[model samples]
Target: MLDSGLYEQLHKALWVQKKLSETVARHWVTTEYQGLTLSSHFQPIFSISHRRPVGYEGLLRASTDSGALIPPPAVLVLPNNSKENLELDRACRQLHLQNFARQETGDCWLFLNLNSQCLVTEQPDAGFMNRLFETTGIHPSRLVIEILESEITDRSYLKQLIKHFRSLGCLIAIDDFGAGHSNFDRIWELEPDIVKIDRSLVQEAGKSSRVERILTGIVSLIHEAGSLVVLEGVETRREALVSIAANADMVQGFYFAKPQQLISSNHEEFVSVIDELLQHQQRQRFKNTHQINENFRKIERLFKRAINHFSVTQNFEESSEILFAEKRSVRCYLLDDAGYQMARNIYSPHYQQTMDVRFTPLLSGDNANWSHKHYHFRAVQHPGQMQLSRPYLSVADSRMCITVSQTVTSSDKQFVFCCDLDWQDN
Candidate 1:
């Protein structure tokens, strides 16, 4: 309903915008992520673990003649003509193919980045990719396609794409997760192979120390989907430390090592560095153990003193008088070779009843080493005699006691009788 001149103006503006976008796309300004030059944060603290090529992450990058790196464009663009899109696909595929070929030096994994728009292309010229894979002969397992799924644009289409690629033996991942503000519903539906924690969240992780609580919950959520979590953008030691504590399975960030050309011969160097760090960590742990042992010794001494006090008391009736004073009851146990197998009690009608009472071993028999069921007692069976006998339980007063009938002797056959204890009843 606009006037002719106004409509023309608006159309011209849109045309200008489109042309500008195309121009930016044409120049390789390095508009995407840089290459595999990742590093670890532990490098500064414990030295870089630089002996082995742990794994290689596919970094998407483009550069112009000026030698400046250009990050890949964030937005998806399709040219007016199918010819341009097809040509672009071919060139991009070739870049990846070449990159992967150079990267397959050992057991290193090739983590390639895939945009949602690209995978769903109707007829991308995948010939170059197929040829590159064929030349490398790397198992599909070695190639992990990292899908930077910001949000589920098309659920059905995304799932179908995942199935197709998975069938090709490639793994799928959903990246830039938290920043994208994605819903857990989308994650459950897509069921990606990996979910990378956003770098933004990691950067803020330790500034408040609240990172762990948040990251832990996030990791727990991701695991419930039957997929692992890879913490991305680990640029600092603090971040790396916290991430590990948060139970991150794998870490990919500049903290370990920046992405680089094939690790080639430097694999051993990486491993050596790791060994050195492990040794240093071990030394620190040893020191900590010594400190803990010293404290434990102090505690042990105190415990022994308390046990000795309990073992040396000899007046049971007198001690129990303070607790059950009116009852005038006294009980004792033997600590000689005639030990009780298990706990038992004996009943006596009068102080002289023990003179004719029959006593049997409480927990006696074959399994002597494991005789924890009973305790030996050289108890005050009568007013003057401390008799040692079998364990017995007395129904008369709900008490466990033993008759002192047998005696223990030393190696020279001398009677030894010093272990007498009387604990105060509460």
Candidate 2:
């Protein structure tokens, strides 16, 4: 009894609904790679601050007909055919989307790995991803595309691809950072939401104090760049502690949980572990700070007493000898307001004897201008206040030393008193 126009519209609506249903059904269909079924296993990525799992990385794994597992590399290997590689990549992504839906992991992001070479070379089907998202019910915003850092060669193409992904509401991450000629310039251009420090760096950091310091510095830089850092490959308590000390935003590795068929159910245990590590770090920091403050106070008192004596002494050389006996100072000199040395340096006898012949040029620094030195300018600004310079190799002895400078007035003439202290002894 409906009008002709209404009947035609209703029939079209029904047909469209049928087609949408078919597309949704097709999204769940599994793909086979070399007669093996592909599936996804998720590894949880935890937030150090929150002490909870913020998201999961979907790792692709294949299973044979006999139910034997196939490693990811084996499944991903393509025989020099771009078409096959693209197909495999699509299949892996689809599998991840399907499994994510099946697992019901709650409002958490799914980090999916994208091959940089594939993305750079292939012209991706725009509608294909739109259809997949629509059919699978996985929103683009909840997905994070992690690109391997080493594989990217053509940055222009990569930037365009990243823009395309972002337009779809997906976040970007640079994985395996600090490995294989990692470029900070490119990273800043990419402006990724996350940077995963390579496992090798994390492992080396745990084993070497120097490497740990470097890792910490790297993490600090990454944070300054407006991105989160994930210290990957933490396999022991020491490694986790190292990551925490580095101030990593997140930590992931076997120490927490290995990549398994299902997301980890032991969230409480991991949280406890993180809390314990944070407590230990806090205690250690408090102890170190207290000790350092005490040491600084002692050093200040020593310098103040020495300066009082030096100001009162009529014989400068005798006072210098007394000061050198009490403190492990290398040399002391007087400089005018213009940063030109006013007198010869009073070098410690023991230090002078050990000085390298190659550095004899430094001994004749009287009347030399030091206006370019940071300590000179800083001391001028804060007259009568002591300023310390960071440790640097001394030009006189080729040994590490710290420079301390103080601007003082004697008989209405302002002069800067500069002293060098052995860094190791200090």
lDDT string for model 2 (1-426, tens) is 999999999999788766754654554446777799877777888899988888888888778899998888887775367777887888888888876775546778898998766766678777878887998788898899998867867878778888888998898999999888997886788999999999999999989876887898899988888999988888999999999999999988899888865554448999888889999999999997797567556556656666666666634465456547635578877788989988788988878767778867777776688877877899999988988886666665677777778887766778777778776532
* lDDT of model number 1: 0.50
Model 1 residue runs over 4 Å out of place are: 1-54, 66-68, 74-90, 119-129, 268-426
Residue-wise lDDT of candidate 1 within 1-426, one digit each (tens)? 999999999999788766654653453222232232211111111112333443466554545556655444521253445555445544554455455454324655566656555445554334545666787577677667767665337777777767777877777878777785577876898888888778888887756544566787788888988887778888776776666656666677776667643333334444554465456556767985687457335333432332233335533223222222212223222232433322222122232243223433432222332113222333212212323333244322333433223233324331212211111122
Task: Please list the C-alpha lDDT of all candidates, in the order they appear.
Answer: 0.50, 0.80
Residue pairs clashing, model 2: none
Model 2 quality (TM-score): 0.78
Q: Superpose all Cα atoms of candidate 2 onto the true structure and report the RMSD in Å to 1 decimal.
A: 11.1
Tally clashes: model 1. 63
